[model samples]
Target: MTQTLEHEEVRIHRGPRSGLPLIVAVHSRALGPAVGGCRMRRYDGWRAGLADALRLSEAMTYKCAVSGLDFGGGKSVIVLDRNAPVTPELRAAALTDMGEFIASFDGTYRAGPDVGTSPADMVVLRRSTPHVYCLPEEHGGTGDSGAPTATGVLAALRAGARHVFGSASFAGRTVVVSGFGSVGSRVAAGLAADGARVLVSDVDGGRRDAARRSGYGWVEPADALGTAADILVPAAVGGVLTPETAARLAVRLVVGPANNQLSDDTVADTLAARGIVWVPDFVASAGGVVHTLGRESEGLDHGAAVRRVEGIGDTVRLLLKGAENPLREAKALVGRRLPPG
Candidate 1:
């Protein structure tokens, strides 16, 4: 793949202690020092992990910009062998090495938890640098950001509901939540509590039982994208909405907390052609960043931080109702906040 050199800085290092590839892409520092999550996951190669880091970091730039955050965007990826055993000892070694790599940036970049990492891992990263967020509440950080993120998604969903269905209520609606993990599970529960018949799906079969136990229907991951429903919350991985799937998506609205939800920009056009209200993922997924930065970095109170997250609904409402193209309107919002290139 021909990679674009649009980012301000990019670095790849092989961890000396863990013998793993540690990739960090600083997409921009125009607003301020970059802030994004550190993701540890299996990848075919270090190059593939770097690709993901590049894409995610750019998305974080838009995410922060649209949310009115002062920070720019950056992301770190620790590539794991596809079939290698991730023993605790090895995990610690990789995390420790990553911490040291992050420390090299001084205060220019900060990291939080994402995907395979957790707040506990942020604790590990903090040992080498203070530029980590979302540490356990006991450790003085705001802790897991899932609830705040889910809250923001619900707010956006309500705005989207009003845009598409002429009401802001989830009542009597059939909703499908893809990916029953931290953020996804909370989104599912919130929708179910709002009187929406929620169906959940996960790539992990173990989550199926948990979904059912929560009084939600379970769909296999293979059948999730095509499952008919009023809305589809893609709380899982990216690339779920492609030209192929967008052609057959059975939902009227597509919104969630996933990053880089579209395979490419063209997919958004396809969704529009299909009359689907696809809220831009960068706009929909800024809650975690907003809450974490507000509480930990900006010294906002808990209630105030939550209020900022809830403001996402207003942002989405403005984007959906104020323009003919919400995606373009959203990018305009980001562009207005971002420094000139």
Candidate 2:
């Protein structure tokens, strides 16, 4: 099936240097120049990668709009064959190819780190274009965005606590954090520090020992959705909050740093029907971009950047408390910020 694009522009280029297929989707330019991360992942096919680029880019539109970032939404994807192993030589070449692709956009689109890409990869990307962001701090850019992202998640979680539990603390609460990666580890640690009983899950069995060392219970990935807890933090991939998962969710509140958490817009209604306070992923996950743009683009000091990231709690509070339907209110907020065509 051919994927239809409602975006401002979508381009697929066969990398002249690496022979990899690179996709860049610019979903909107209503507010300003488009900005999003470069996601390099192994896909069954380039079409699947293109679909991800389309969906993630559109989510970034709402992410930026709702977070009050001036930038619009865009994303770049490097599609790798699922069966092929990525050699260091091949990885370097792909970054160069991605850089070249972003360079072609001039400044209309900028690339940052996401998923498989990193600040080191951004350094390699700088070899081709200046539109790359979150380069290592020593290179005049903020380093890994995971910390700020976790900070924002915790902030949102606190607000969710207040809205759902009538308290602002996670003390005596049981929070399930799915995906024990960089951001998930940090969120789990924060929850533990706040006296919450944190259960961590990851598809990677290697992380089990680390979760145990942190005094967190380990739940198998398959059981995470149905595990009873006060909250569920999905810090991994998108599309985890589908209708089927929402039906069995044992948590009172759902929020995390995962982008495109809902499989579709209708999942929001399904969650509402289930009585789950599902904070929009864009709102909860904006801290990384918020902090990066604050420090790099806005010339904010470190303290200012940190403070701005913490403001996500306030945003979540307003969204949850102001209306009967938070997702509807959030979409309305995004609609207001976006200029009419």
Question: For model 2, which pairs clash?
Answer: none
- The residue-by-residue lDDT of candidate 2 on 1-341, one tens digit each, is 99755799999999887789999999999998899999999999999999999999999999999999999999999999999988998888889888988999998999999989999899999988999899998998998999999999999999999999999899999999999998999999999998999999999999999999999999999999999999999998899988899999999999899999998889899888878899999999999999998998999998999999999999999899856667898988899999876
Range of the 10 consecutive residues with the lowest summed lDDT in candidate 2: 321-330
- How does each model score on TM-score? 0.97, 0.98
Candidate RMSDs in order: 1.6, 1.6
- Give the lDDT of residue 294 in candidate 2: 92
Native-vs-model 1 lDDT? 0.93
Where does the lowest 10-residue lDDT sum fall in candidate 1?
320-329
Residue 218's lDDT within candidate 2 is: 92
